[model samples]
Target: MAQIDTIIASPSPVECRRLQNILEKEPDFRILAQARDLSQTYTATEALSPAIVLISQSFAALPEFEVMHMLFRVLDTRWLVIENGDACTPHLKITRNSDLFTIDLRSGGAGLVPLIRSVTRAQRRKMVPARPVRQSMPGQKKLVMIGASTGGVDALATLLSGFPTDCPPTMIVQHTRHSFGGSLIGLLDRQCAAHVMPAKDRMRLDPGTICIAAGGRAHMQLAISHAPQVRLVPSAPVSGHLPSVDAMFHSALRVAPRTVAVLLTGMGRDGARGMLELRQAGASTLAQDEASSVVYGMPKAAWENGGAQKRIPLVDMAAEILKAASMSGEEAKP
Candidate 1:
């Protein structure tokens, strides 16, 4: 297991205790330091070199932008800003301007755990390699498969919104708790002009539509029946995940060998081997760049394994996918 160095900042003792309790639950995480003031937080992060910093809006007297700028400039650590209460604070609102930090209210602490875990998992998965892939053939309809977990809701929203309505038939495996799956789909549908739906078993690939895997009962798979279609399988978790990215990518490669497989911001290497298979099958592959990834695990693993042909930022991924798919004549029209 990989260890995470962490820093916590909160002006109040109660808030500090809450964050401390949360960190204590994760064995792989170590508290490098804690601070209640802006100056102290900046000093501690720079000296400790923590990978992530958890900060509350009430922390210190400094303005939120100053604190955020300092953290980014000094440590380059990922920041998770916890709002003080139900009402959005001015600092919290300002924090949202930067893509580097994730903002959430303290009332949503239950959701925070999963996001932290996802980042931790991503860090661990980044160390893995994607080896033993086959090369792609030229001029084939290229399928692009993507997977994300934890802070993936916002990350996916940011990445997918850039996609045009005519973007290639893209499939996504996003890790969300059961009840939130539909809401997740709804969010994406509203954000992107592209059609987004919960993937159903045996639904044929249609241009300009995005299929997202639903949680709970069914696992999404790519099935070949006359032609390739999204198939929902009732099966146990593979790689500790259902609607596994690996499963989707593996099936996509089998159905369309010369596809593009992308492993985006997520925790764990669920799609590492599948990405390798796609590479071996002569498919173009990409990983999300580390700087832009909330957690760089999945993409890093794919890159290390020699599976990724390119590593791009989240903002640019849709365009890159379109470019790659166009080479295979599967380009969606504008």
Candidate 2:
């Protein structure tokens, strides 16, 4: 069994000791380090890349907490935050922004162990390879629609890098942090031949430019017209995600005369049903094969739910896209 390493960050030495004691009881967990201050926490995290970071509420008020939070999100590290309360009624807070899970610290910390175990299980799943699969999607693709979540940054970079400067107009929806749209587009722009940028509301969909769904409290959809454009609308979260892939996929079904939908690595089933709808509407659909996904959950869900018409490896996805676009038959070997 693989063991999970952790770093405990607590402003109070007594609270740090208490967490350490509780964690020590689990055979599969190892305490890598403990920090009582911001400086120590920074040094410890840099020196030892722990799987999980247990943070006490005292650290939340400091400016350093913001930096640490960003660092953890970028590194894909799990954080569990213990609320500021005594043993009787401790609460835990978990959110997409904070990337932390809150739990009651009373009852001799019974809930802590299970939470850690669940986190470890998820991490282990990410480490494992996906099984082999084969799928086929045939269409004359005019517009390309893509959806991704975990591992999307790297996957998009690789896929777009193979695209020609004259590639078809492409729209993408990726689950990410607020204000991360610029950074993601910038990163992708550096790696790909096609221009990459954030989608502007009412901006015309142009050939050779890839528009990414803006990250925030809205769903990014397309407006039907002589010249289709991107539109951001405030709405309830669909499939547990704002800017949901499902929303984008379902929208593609409306304008499906010549479109292709591709679903990539992510967790949950947000895009599964929507992809199925696109396929039923005569649009081609593709999904990332398991072996290459950082998390196979989303693509797996899409494939299993009869949403994906083709399952392709990450290395070959770009070639496949170009092939579907009728750009070149010579590059279809992947």
Candidate 3:
């Protein structure tokens, strides 16, 4: 694992010292500097360029913090926000949330180390910024977006097994833990002909390769690029997920006419509204049939809300997805 350099910034001197002490105990973490105010935080960050920044919610609410945030984001610095006065942290927010996390300091500082580790791991995935979009491509491009949760591991293995080596660019958001993401990728790669890998920030989406966002500290979204790159942004959880299906689907709206969006077995309604928006934007959309889904929560919500154009069985899902993805940009629209 790469070393994680960090900056501890807080208006309170006590808070800064607290974080410095906690991080010092970790073998992987190195503190570049500690700041007593937002001003010093900016100076240290500009000089040291730390991998992560530990901050308080109070400083983040300040106007200057926003501008500094914008400047620092280009450097790939992820934030760990500390909030005071919470009875305790939310279970979902702390354990299974995005890289840019806010935890209740009132409970304890124990959550800080884990949050820092998650962000550090996420950074190693090459979270770069997206390049500017090109005007046109010689050949028409097609994209696929799939979302899954509960029982998704087996379901994804089965669905991906049917894809050809030359299949369209596909991005998937599957709910899991950050710690288990590498194993998930390895498992999917072994099961499928297409190259299955963790989604990198600004990675070019290409045919025959699949990028997955599962239990990462960031949200994976489609960004403007010649090949339509994946952009990973560290943010608060969306639809109760860090690497949320909703974020991915919503981000692809501009390319909806050339997209095929699918919702599969999941325990929540994360992709329902996003799928509906995609459908309305002329994308081809589908959901897994209840009988085929391990848990039918997400697909059911999508079907009920008129988000899915069809509900196909798991056995036929790969075939249907392939068909949609093979369509010409003009031919793919609803």
Candidate 4:
């Protein structure tokens, strides 16, 4: 098997040697060169172009996030950062249940290799094309808002499976990493009958179709132009997140008179405030019960904050949403 080439960039010689010794033991990893500064690291990277660049936070000089953006955009290099055992300086922040990804030098090199492999696989998976939404005619214009995070993928699959083929137009914001949005759309498309796709700016929300919030490049929002359309607006992270659940929920309030908001499993309180606003606007709202939620943070927050009017389980969530929109019955229930 081919070894994964790497460049170690650390300010301290001791740390560099330690990392080199540890990673060298792994047959799959091959250290090409070591650099003491960003300049040397950049030169070595341009020349060696290794698969992975392992750098220490201190040697990075600039802010960690700035360095990350610069490397990702300018060099297009896949790199991992070591925070020097500082829990406050997070190494990785992305989608999925775990908000942060870190590697502890104390644990030796055992966990390091596996985590890199997982990230590499995910990067590869992100390149796969998402299944396109099959075009269909518009249905009842009533809208449905869904917010989820953490173990939301499976829960969403179960709830969406119960959606009728002609279910109301739906907008979903599931906290996820950038490139992972396409993969999530493909996953849900397979598990459910709805025509699911990544929401594009100004894309109309037709009936029987589901628009999902994307990451990385743009954040998804709602607007009423020619029709209820998805808006991909460029904006900084809100509540520490792009395509924030609160953003969507607040927008739904503008159409609350004909909207049904559903809050699912997630971490944090991103959607709680929006749900509360929706409740105040006289919109029908549902939150997944704690027993059915993965983290129960967002839903629990909404329920406690008096934003959720009905607490439903994953199995019953779809039925409740459909019923609230007057789409329930033998023909509409899945």
Error of 4 at 133 (Å): 17
Give lDDT tens digits, candidate 3, residues 19-46.
7777888898988888877767877886
Best-fitting candidate, measured by lDDT?
A: 3
- Superior by lDDT: candidate 2 or candidate 4: 2
Q: Give the TM-score of candidate 2.
A: 0.59
Off by over 4 Å in 2: 1-141, 327-334
Using lDDT as the yardstick, the better of models 1 and 2 is 2
Candidate RMSDs in Å, in order, are 16.0, 10.9, 12.5, 8.7
- Global lDDT scores for all candidate models: 0.69, 0.73, 0.78, 0.72
Q: What digit string (tens of lDDT, one per residue) describes model 1 on residues 206-272?
A: 6667899846566788776776688888888877888788878777766554477788877788888
Model 2 vs truth, CA RMSD: 10.9
Q: Compared with the true structure, what per-residue lDDT tens digits does model 2 show for residues 1-334?
A: 6888999988887778889888887788999998987557756875686788888766654422544564464456688777657432111121233456776565556688889778757752232221112122243347888998866766786788777766778889888766556656665665566778787788888777789874667787878798878888889999998989899888877766467789988778888999889877777778999988867888999899887878999999987776766522222222
Candidate 3 wrongly placed segments (more than 4 Å): 1-141, 329-334
Query: lDDT score, residue 70, model 2?
Result: 45
TM of each candidate vs. truth: 0.58, 0.59, 0.58, 0.58
Task: Please state the error at residue 175 of candidate 3 in Å.
Answer: 0.2
Residue clash pairs of candidate 2: 92-102, 92-103, 93-102
Q: Clashing residue pairs in candidate 3, if any?
A: 99-217
Q: After TM-score superposition, what is the CA distance of residue 103 in candidate 2 from its true location, in Å?
A: 28
